[model samples]
Target: MKIGLYFGTFNPVHVGHLIIANHFAEYSDLDKIWMVITPHNPFKKKKTLLDNHHRYQLVLEAVEEYPAIEASTIEFNLPQPNYTSNTLAHLKEKYPQHEFCLIMGEDNLRTLHKWKNYEVILKHHDIYVYPRIADSEDQTQHELLNNERIHIIEAPVVEISSTAIRKAIKAGKNCRPLLPQSVWRYIDEMNFYK
Candidate 1:
């Protein structure tokens, strides 16, 4: 089995996340796309993040109808500041039968060098990078671009962002179009981001 890991904080699962995962499941060689919910990202601030369980549930609700995508809480059990390379190593060791690939946006490619064991990640796993609206041309022209392990996929570009959604919710605005119905209902019922 081939799995593509779409790792993120997913503070609140939105349409954009679903779109990319769907595209990978349909267009890429991946049999399934797992949205690995990272409890804590070393580079991101923890204060702005929602609870891991709540965020995980939101992802589950958002992808419930889509069999091709799954919500993984793999990072929840791991140590703080969950590193991609560490998670990748653990997954590879546990599921040796499955071929694991990393799915990320082109913007992250620019900062790949900042990640822990980034070189080892590039060498071992195949990466599928989707386009980001604000990604610079120079950022995409990294040395890894020539590596066969890295693939640039033309997935749909969604302008919607989790920060925008959170702001909308705090302002008491309707953001249903930017999120799945289930997720929107959950956020509304729980009064999240208020």
Candidate 2:
């Protein structure tokens, strides 16, 4: 089976995230897309991250309706400051029957070299990159022309961002549309990340 590993902090899984995952499932050769919930990203600030379990539950709630999309907590059991290579290695050991590929945005592609064992990752697995706001056609050209394992997917361009959503919530603005109804309700009821 071809599985695309979609990793993210998922502070609160939003509609934009669901849309991207759906697009990848629809357009790619992937049979299923797993949303890998990471406790903390090495590149991102640790302070902004939500509790690992909470984030995992949010992803579960957000992707519950999509049969093709499933939420994963593989990172939760892994070491702190989760790295892609380590997670992939563990997953390979556990599920040798399925092939796992990386799913990310063009923005992340630009910083791929900074990731641990990036060369090994690029050589071993297929990478599907969706274009973000900052990463334009030029970035796509660079990625496609430079790597044979890379595929640039044309997903929807939404201005929504997790940082913006968090800010809106802090400013006493409505975050209903930015996130899934379940996620919003959970955040409101629990007063999370405030």
Superposed Cα deviation of residue 94, candidate 2 (Å): 0.7
Clashing pairs in 1: none
| lDDT per residue (tens digit) for residues 1-194 in model 1 | 99999999998889999999999999999999999999988888899899999999999999999999999998888888889999999999888999899999888887887889988998899999998886247644568788899999989987788988999999989889999999999999998999
lDDT of 2 by residue, 1-194 (tens): 99999999887789999999999899889999999988888878988888888888888889888999999999998999899999999999999999999999877887787789998998889999887888245554475546988988878876678888888888889879889898898888889857
TM-score of 1: 0.97
Global local distance difference test of model 2: 0.87
lDDT scores for all predictions? Answer: 0.91, 0.87
Clashing pairs in 2: none
Question: Per-prediction TM-score, please?
Answer: 0.97, 0.93
Q: What are the RMSD figures for all models against the true structure?
A: 1.2, 1.9
How many clashes does the backbone of model 2 have? 0
Query: Lowest-lDDT window of 10 residues in candidate 1?
Result: 134-143
- Candidate with top lDDT is 1
Leading candidate by TM-score: 1
